[model samples]
Target: MIIITAILQMLRNGFVLSKTVIFIWGLVLSHALVSNGVVDVFADFLGDEKYNLWKAIMVKSFLEGLSAVLKVAVIHVSEAYIGRFKAIIFCTGSFTMGLVLLWIRASHLDIVTLIFAIVLIALGTAGKEPTLRDFFDYQLREKVKKNCTEKNEGEDKEPSQEKERSGKNDSAATNLWWSTASIIGSVIASFFLSSDHWGENFEISSIVMGATCLLFIIGIFCYYPEEKPSESPLTIPYRVFKAAIKNRRLSYPSSKQDYNNEDSDDASSEDFFYRTENGEVHLLPRHPSFSLFLDRAAMMNNSDDEEKVRKEEVCTVVQVRDVKNFCLIIPLVVTLFSYNLVSTSGNTYFVLQASTLSSYNIGAFDVSIMALFAIKSLITFVVRTIQSRYKVVRPLWSIAVGMFFSVLCCIAAWQVERRRLYLKKPDDDIPMSIMILTPQYFLLGLMEGFAEGGLKNFLSDRLYSESMKNFVEPYIEMLLGIGKFSSILFALVFYKWIKDEINHSRLDNYFLVLASLSFVYLGIYIFYAKFKFQRRRVAVPAETIQETIERMDELLQVEVDINQ
Candidate 1:
């Protein structure tokens, strides 16, 4: 979707596909090839062949969880030192190396080698993914800006309408393209992994990854370089935290008027609330609610040492607001962990379950279990289209809908498992058709598209400062890592309870537990949506306030639509 979007965007702009865009596309393609095509199958192979069912689940889960953590850590530590492009290249190289290692270890079947390969792959993946996403977003923004500039110059009237239409079309095109690529990757990977005619899946994966690395390198020169930040991006959040702590004793202004009344030494300055050291106005107005203490970070304090005061009060109101926005979104982000806990089981337990059921046959070809994931890609396209068509752009509401789907998926899976358990045979395949589980996969995919899309939109839109926006992808990655890690821990407990007793093991019970947990979190999400983040109506002219309220009400209506 991202690759196609960039291509369409370039086409729309009357520019040839830029080298940078191509390189980014290559990165995305390579990622799909490895992640969808190789990794899951390799993990499954190890589990089914080398170890028992429970051990296999643990291996895949542990490797994924650990790798997620490593990726987040590597990105955090290295992103500042190396710019996003370089970081992406570094990750791609690491992943390629890991693939090579996996190929070498294939015959030996050394667990240690496999572990090392997993770690390296994880590190590479973690580093590249967030940076890649941010890069795409950066490109999209630039494209939009360029289009707006052109529209403003070329068409004086209807620029807003044209821009809106163009933006929607471009976004839809990109999403469709991304989904298509993912589906292709999934199908290709499944074929190689499942078919005996394709020499070992690991070998095929290694070759694909190597080619992907080459493509990544080839496109490096084409990328438009972003200016490197003077300070570590990590420092912004830390500075906000420190400044807020320092000003904890300070009191907030009684009213917006009080905030505006404070006179600055510079009479020429018109702005209030927060000013830069050189007396420039900030883009965002002061937000008094939700971590209001952070407002003190931008408050000017009179000190004996002018230099000290300048240094201490340098943080912008926008920056403080950015930090507060992040804080506000943390609870919503944490909800993904619960969603992931249930979702991750799909790749492991669900796949295993499918394998035990009767396969779908189409003449000469038997459908691979991994190919079923294309169902998700399909559902995502449909959902996103419906969303775009109706202008249903409420991200949080989308997330809630996604959560609801996830709960449904769990319930469906539980029922399927319950039936399978009841109809168990000693040595034969389960009587149930693998297609019985298609609904769960479809729901899982819908959950992913909506929840992830919502989360991304929420983070990107809510941020008040452009400077702080780059952190959004990394924050998301960190949250996903946390979720993956937490899921592994939960899986371990569940595995212990079920423990290698294939027939006797009540995996259905685990799914039931997940469904119950999801329900609880869904209710909490509703509460948060309703009470925690209510829109504050700023004091203004009645007409202006009425318009603002109407806009807010429109957004709330979208939420209502999502619930319906």
Candidate 2:
């Protein structure tokens, strides 16, 4: 309800509200549907076999990479569209294809069927999605601009003297109305999608979704004006509308009643900073937002000059030469130890150990331990909620805590492995009790909740610069994809090295590797603290070339201060 109200106010302020809402809705739905679909498909392919951790990880990574490729391809193709509605349709169709692939996998469909489906989906996505949307937006923007100018001219209003146009007008109340309707439609669609019954009703849900999509797209095309003024673009008004809707300029008391509800407060804030650009120095307000105005192409033109500075900095690499040299040695040891611990960790052996204890029949998704893993994910979700609600745990601190928990989880798994080893005294006898391994899997989920979650937040916060914050989510996801790729490569190498060894029950050896890696990482972190890391690097103005050179030289000469 609050989101709905806030969205309404945003639209009233004249912003392009539908696209943003759609993007968010699309991201959530796409992720959920794709995640479930892929998991279902992969479980079918793998069956209930007790493969090594490496093989499981490999299949997961490969599927993830394939998903990434599909996503990227869809995005590129969608960009060519002039009509946004056309693009949306294109994207929806493309992503649906990916979803279908998973469905086929889950159904244990033939390889030929899967191949044929993929080829068709790929072709549809690559050929159609991009161009339609690009064409739509281009035409829509051009028309809207012309209409706005004509409307102003009829009223004999003076043209805006502002040099820039920001896309805020698209967020105005009317625009919000469109978006609100879209959100409603999306929410409705989510309900049907979420339901378990698919007997004949599945087609109905698909029809509803298709109809809603068409309605929204057609509404945009028919409602928006056909021509725009060449003299006055829609940019400035859009910019103004954006600022007003975002509530970028105001501060309110934390008490709920301090302002007349969130919407009123937002409206008040919008009034304060509408159409304003540039921030005053040394005036940091409680809530602040900045817009990126500079063009990236302009920045790229200066990259040649940027490389020279990097080269000179490399020369000064010798200043801390002794320190970095010493630091480099630790990661190798840490890498080995961390790998060792993880190998024997509960997650690594959970599957093999769990199957023998009882007849844990596979779920509809074909997963052997659905109920257990789902509960773990739920616990992690609760932990995440608690962490978010209470600001007690800082991002980096959460990361540190997660790492601690991960180590503990690994150690606990080591204990289980040892117990299992002891119980199987010489005559191939395995422990039938699964309860022993339960805590290890539980801890793995907890560790994931803390460490991986924290790492994700930290990386996103640190690497997403002001200009590229919008792209940060995708970029980080791409990095995650890269990490998975690396993990796959690492597993392949490990398999090659150990495949020849006899009885190779090197499980203990693997556990040791991870534990040692963690310690090694800790040491390297200390070294980073002692030498390489810097807390606050305030840029000193260097107006002249000589001054700039000296400044660079000074930075090179000084050892990096770890503590800010």
Candidate 3:
């Protein structure tokens, strides 16, 4: 009830409840339905005698994560050209085809067929589910801008604060629904999945997916404006890098006036400062020591007086700032891999280990162990509740907190797995209580709430550009995909550690390795947060490189002192 109230309150504060948002929410339900329902049950359904963890679980997981990384290309390259609607349609087709392939696999029980199906579904969900939600936010903002402008024009009235769109609140509300649907999907899947009922699970997932797709189609036709291929934001980084390389020798002008004069067009050159979503203008640093090559692109004056550089070879001051920030963000994305890599690998292993335990019951019927995977979503829902109640918005620090917990979760898994293995020496089935896994799931839930929710807040709060914000979300998913891709590498690297039977496999060692690397990456995050990200970045007055560095250090010292 509190969650529902939060949703209504958020919508009341200038949310447009657009068709695109509904479509995205539906996509989330469809994906969640299959993931917790079908993926983990593969070995059991296909007969554990024939399939093992390597084939049934790890193989499917690998391709799914790999597909997520691959979706970056599909989203930017293909979606950039064919229009978002067509790209969405193509992804929807893949999702439907995957379910059809799953139905076929049920009969033949082919590994190749199952893998192909998993890839298709992963590509569809990864490419669309998150992407659509972001698009909804973008579209919502655009609509708000339009409506506000029209009202102002008509009445000569100033747009109120309530009329201004709040992306953070709106995004939180969207996440609330998405998380709830995910939990429900997991529970629904449990009822539909047993060894004999696995076929029914896929069949139901296909129907749900199809129904959602139909709804999205109807919504698009009813509400979508005519599609136009906008200039891809992906090209911004390329242009900045290209211009930086071409004009590396050139130095920036002494005055803001000269910078303004260097503008290729009045539109790009309009300001040295960029406006945030809340109407605060942050003036970018004029001459920062870091990435000085980027500063050169802002200088329009050629060293050779008679020589002329092409238009494509130069960008405005604001573009240079945007590009430099983009570069800084890419390295930090590696540290984010710490959590995703651990979760992607640990989740399937958790389910397999759960099956080995004596089944727990609720009254008459036994509960599906896979339903435990829903705990993360449940925690996320709790985070949403706290956020809605308190209006919390600590974006970057929340992410760090999430990463910290993720390392602990990996450690917890390692200890529990080691203990489980120790007790399994005499009997393959140790009759261990399922309660042993509860703490791991509990920690995972905290990680999900902070890490995932924090990422959402970070995007809505820190990022200044709408175009960049939209692209960054997909980029983050790609990072997660890379994390997923690395899981395959880990399994191969520790091949002997993973056996056909859970009892024989030394997975505790595997968890240990993941925890160690995640700990190292967590250290990187702390170092970067303290020294790099927290520092007074390239967003200040025109100053000499030395003065800029000193100022940044001084400001960083203040921040550190405050933290202490």
Candidate 4:
């Protein structure tokens, strides 16, 4: 719900959705219909009949965490090889297969089948995330380009036509319609599969998953094909790493004259570093910080043959700088894992805590835990809207504020748990109203609004190379997966001491521990943001490059005509 809500808000703020994004969201909505309601029920079933509560919790966490890891691995390996549309198709197909297996397991009450299905579902769901994000980003860039072109052309147009033709409002509305469809699908599924209708839940969920697969197939042609690099995308990074190591001991030029000396007189004046025998530029100017040794890959030796140098050194300075760019952002990315660790607790332990409280009645219907997620989503949307309107654009500052709220969320949970423990008797319902948990949920939503948006903006703006931009989504997803996996491990270790039984559990202590970690992480992030990180220079516009090429082509054609 948080993720869906965030994407919708982003769309409203002019973010675009491609067919890949729509297909991925469809699969997600299908999975949510099953997982959100069924997983808890499945866990309860196991706890009540087959296993202990701790074991059930471990089983659920392990499947989810392992799935996340596998998802990252698959995306990292396959994203370069496959187109985004094909990847979506493959992932959605996997999801459909997993749903089939899940249906079988549910019907037969077979634990082994259930376990296998869980693994398959994890794999399918994991791969879709980064791919969908990349597609959305691409579409967003296209939208920005269109808007820029329109603004440039608006000067010559009549005011009425210009107003009528503005793409911004139309684009936003289109994105909103897609987001609304996604939300509506999830809500419909949730209504059919919620606790009140547990008996037919798996059957309904399987049908939804099948329908989602068909929907994805229908939209396969809707997205524009992502541009494929002429050379293998991985080649540059691999060559950079290899060259950095191979040239580690080489001495760099000591003077400006040495740096400027070239083996060939015909080298292009635009070349920042050495030029190849074939007239290709080899490098750009080196970055000033971290991984400075990579610059040695571009250093020219006085005795070296130009052809031999070209053959031996395949990396460009731009590629080396790209690697360095990732190095600079490592600290910030690592800090996010800490925030993710705290966030994981919300989905697992916080839900458990909420389940124990007296249910809130909305007239005839008692509000389920899933409904609380809607409340959080609503709050996040409101917060994001306000931020967008004010143009409060400091991402790092927003992330810092989010971290602070995360700490407060933990503190709130700890206090509530402490109170519940003090007030409740054995076998008695929790004396506190479920609404007491509302503040934590609201704070979490606010934290997500600030932190996630800030991180996305910061990384996208700071990355230098076009190729490197593709990596931002996978890298963030990897961190999130690791955070969830690590949190589960942390919980397991603490479980020996804290136990899983609600009556005897010291879960408040766990929340306190996370609160402390969040506080420490916030301090470290602040220090890194202030003193250590340096933003890369903005990349040249692709449109400008394309125009220059077109102009050169026109001049060449004119020269040919004159010669004829």
Candidate 5:
């Protein structure tokens, strides 16, 4: 449906560069090839009869979690030091290098290649991913903004309908390409991993990655619009923390001089608001308690040192407010763990369960158990089309829908595992068909389609400003890592349930406990969503009062559209 929309929109509104679709295809391919490909890769270790099976699976989770941790550091360097474009170049280069190493690992099958390849692939893609997603929207927005400005300056005073149309088309086109890649990649990987030709799959993956990277780089110069990176939002917190430490002994200043100008932040507003990367001026919800302490970090000091006076000008006011909001947003970001946990299980335990099931051959091709993840992706192919038509009205609601799907997946898995165990004879192989796991995989695909995107929207779309989100974006990505790592801990705590053979382990019990935990997590999420974040009108920054007023209506409309 989304693909159809893109074609029709292109036909009606004319067209864009063919390379635009190609560029989007390359980006989506980079994302898709590894979206959950590692599960199969780890399953290969078990199939090869190499290391201990369960440990190999845990290693995969650990490496993924570690890569997620590295994502934060890499993004920090990208956003804070090198420009995002350059960071992507460096990261993509790393990712490509990882792919080459992964190909070598596939060919040789050794510990050295194995460890280095997975880490670099995981690390490089982790850095590229969140930035790539953000950059995609960022460049499109800048292009549309420039077009509108140019058109408005002319006599007609109309917006650039072409650029606006292009934005809509690009959004649809990207979704279409991403779904196409997921389906093709999943099917191809599943087919290849089932046989001795799995190494060829890696070889093919590496080659495609190289070409895509080249196209992505070329498109940047010739096709995509150029926009300079904003000053990193992260600098604010660094300065605030540094100042807080220096002024540690100082009491929370209560004087009027300590506060920012009322006009800068609309101090009279009942509550505070934040926004996306290119968002309106925002004020964070203030806490009378710790906020006063953060205030000292920005407030004028008693000492009239020349350096202090100069630094205070840049660091006070907006910086502290953003930092306070950062503090407030942390808990919400942490609340995202349940979805991450469910997602990790999709890649880890689901693959394990599928590996243990009986395989049915289709004509000449033997579709392996690992292809179950592909089934999940195939479901995603359908879900993305449906999702485009009816977006969730609120960020919280999107999250709720996603989490609900995840909980259902857990329940379904619990039932399936119990059934598989029940029918198994004491001394014979389990006779369950791979098709038996289809429902749970479908549930997982639904969870993947909605939950992750919903979580991202809450942060990068509505809850953060351009400067503010840079601080939290990587951490939010960390939820993926945290979930994977926690799986290791969960395995340790419930060691009896994770073993070389699913039939031996109490996996049904494990899934049931997981379902119960998910229910609790969902309850917690609902509790926080009810009281934690609220929308209210906010004031512009001290520096942009006039420009902000001109943009306020547009900003409000953006917020309204996001909610409904």
Candidate 6:
């Protein structure tokens, strides 16, 4: 009876959680619809008024800036002495409220009305993410710093220049070069694929694909191990950028008088730590390393305690540091083609295979795709749960395997397409089994599960040592926006080139491209894993419990050294 009661209670809680997720999803969906609608309306109005492309661009940019300003203003208002959680809830509420207005007006459907409504909703949603992130990071920083020291009396001091070297310096030039090459190739591919005179003008698409593959090969050759640098004494970039940016001012001290006034007392360095204007309190560590400086800053909202301090503070800060190279650009760009390839793979097979299969319904909206996604989500949840229990298996391995499976699914689809084309069935409704589509979607979902989970953990692990770690949360959110934008680039390119000629064979070829790309990506990741330290563990001295206690007692009695 107790077990039954507990099960009932758990079911109730699950339902509540489901309702909350659905509500949030609906709100986001509504916002997207409204925002896009508004953009379309504005573009139409500009076109009607004969505004040139440059003028339209300027106007859009100005509107975006105005939206940003308004969002920032709201953040400041909400941030006034409020807790981080409250600030985030307030911002999310504001955006949701705007979305609610659009949902209320679902009865009316005019281009101008839709446009204005969406713009208003978007304004409420835009910049809220970054602002909320800033609030969270601010809270985390304070909580972590507070856990180290009990003193609320003095500010924390800045670490020295040597400490700043803990973070990795990924070469921005390499990233930029690779990203540029990919972009140029994409453009060339787009041109060749879209042009009707493809045979005469150029077979540029094939050439671009070949070049991109070559670039990946070159990256493998050029890669080299980076030497680990010695630990620094000081924490660099003491001032958090968000605070400075929010206030719209530089944080540098104005004069020597200001510096002296700030740290007025010259106490014994060993007796008392000096706190800087920023929240950091710096002191020398109790060892021989001159370059080692200890920073004791309160993590926001955390009480001072040893165990909690270890959890809050970054361990092996160098391993987790941020590197701002263009490594992400290629991944971002490739995802566009990847999404396009997967989305169109179904359509391509539909056209090419439908004519051949006698039993299949061609171009039918398989609602099963949605069901499959839900199933995939459930699978991911289970996998993640197991991962929590198991220590060894990482989620990234799943992602790598998922992509490989995707290749297999593509192969299966290609086979179906080839079979249909060759057999030449008499019936118009030649149908392939629904199962053919399942693997593709399942693989995609698996990819999403692994990629999303792994990427978050990877970035979080690395972001702490970044020069701008304090402001990283928001910028990371911004990078997501950039990723989405890159993905959309493929949609535009595909519409331009293959809208008319979207066939099973063409799509088969497309999936082949995606498979090749995924393979190369997997290889690069494997290579990186080989050179990079997977994780760091501290070394402990080996001593029996009895011997250690005896040595401790003797040392207390001033008897002898344990080493001797």
What value does the lDDT take at residue 218 in candidate 6? 40
- Residues 447-551 of candidate 1 have per-residue lDDT tens digits of 877877777677777675555676676676566656765666786677754656445677889889999999999988878776555442222336855776799
Question: What's each prediction's TM-score?
Answer: 0.77, 0.46, 0.77, 0.73, 0.75, 0.41
User: What shift in Å separates residue 68 of candidate 5 from its native position after superposition?
Assistant: 1.7
What's the C-alpha lDDT at position 431 in model 1?
Answer: 85
- Report the alpha-carbon TM-score of model 4 versus the true structure: 0.73
Q: Tell me the number of clashing residue pairs for each predicted model.
A: 5, 58, 0, 0, 3, 30
Evaluate residue 251 in candidate 2 and report its C-alpha lDDT on the 0 to 100 scale. Answer: 40
RMSD of each: 8.4, 16.6, 8.1, 9.1, 7.8, 19.5
How does residue 166 of candidate 3 score in lDDT?
A: 45
Q: Which stretches of candidate 2 lie over 4 Å from their true place?
A: 1-45, 49-56, 66-368, 379-391, 417-438, 452-467, 496-512, 529-531, 535-564
Reference-based lDDT, residue 33, model 5: 62
In model 4, which runs have C-alpha deviations exceeding 4 angstroms? 1-53, 74-78, 107-114, 133-178, 195-199, 219-236, 254-290, 297-313, 378-393, 534-564
Model 4 per-residue lDDT tens digits across residues 1-564:
645564655566654434455664676566555555565344434433345447656666666666667765666555557766666666666766766776556535566776777777677676556665555445545545566566767466565654454444444544454445545654654344554343466567667778877876776566555786244335656676787687778666553233323333434333333323243333332333456676665555546636645685635444665666555556676887668876666666776676567877777666666665656655665665555445375877877888888999999988998998888787856777878888888888888777766665666665556667766656555556666667667777777545646556888888888889889999988887765543322223457567778999999999999999
Mind giving the per-residue lDDT tens digits that candidate 2 earns over 241-330? 343344333442222222212113244232221122243111111111222211111111123524633432111111112122222223
lDDT of 3 by residue, 1-564 (tens): 766676666555534555556766676677777777765454455334357667645665676566667677666754468766666767877888888778757766666776788778777766565455555445555555565566567575645643544433455455555555677777776666554466666787778888887877777754446356665677877877787787677555544444423433455334435322243222253223466567666555655422333455656565666666555555666777768776775456776777677766777656666656666557766774565355464666777777888888889999999888878847576867876787788888887777766665554444455667666657666666676766666678788998877778998998888888888888888787667655754433356456757888999999999999
Worst 10 residues of 2 by lDDT: 292-301
Q: What's the TM for model 1?
A: 0.77
Q: Candidate 1, 199: how far from true, in Å?
A: 7.0
- Root mean square deviation (Cα) for candidate 1: 8.4
Off by over 4 Å in 1: 1-24, 41-43, 66-79, 133-180, 195-199, 220-226, 229-232, 253-290, 304-313, 335-337, 381-393, 492-497, 535-544, 547-564
How well does candidate 3 match the true structure in TM-score terms? 0.77
Indicate whether candidate 1 or candidate 2 has the larger lDDT.
Answer: 1
lDDT of 6: 0.36
User: Which is the better candidate, 2 or 5, if ranked by lDDT?
Assistant: 5
Q: How does residue 111 of candidate 5 score in lDDT? A: 72
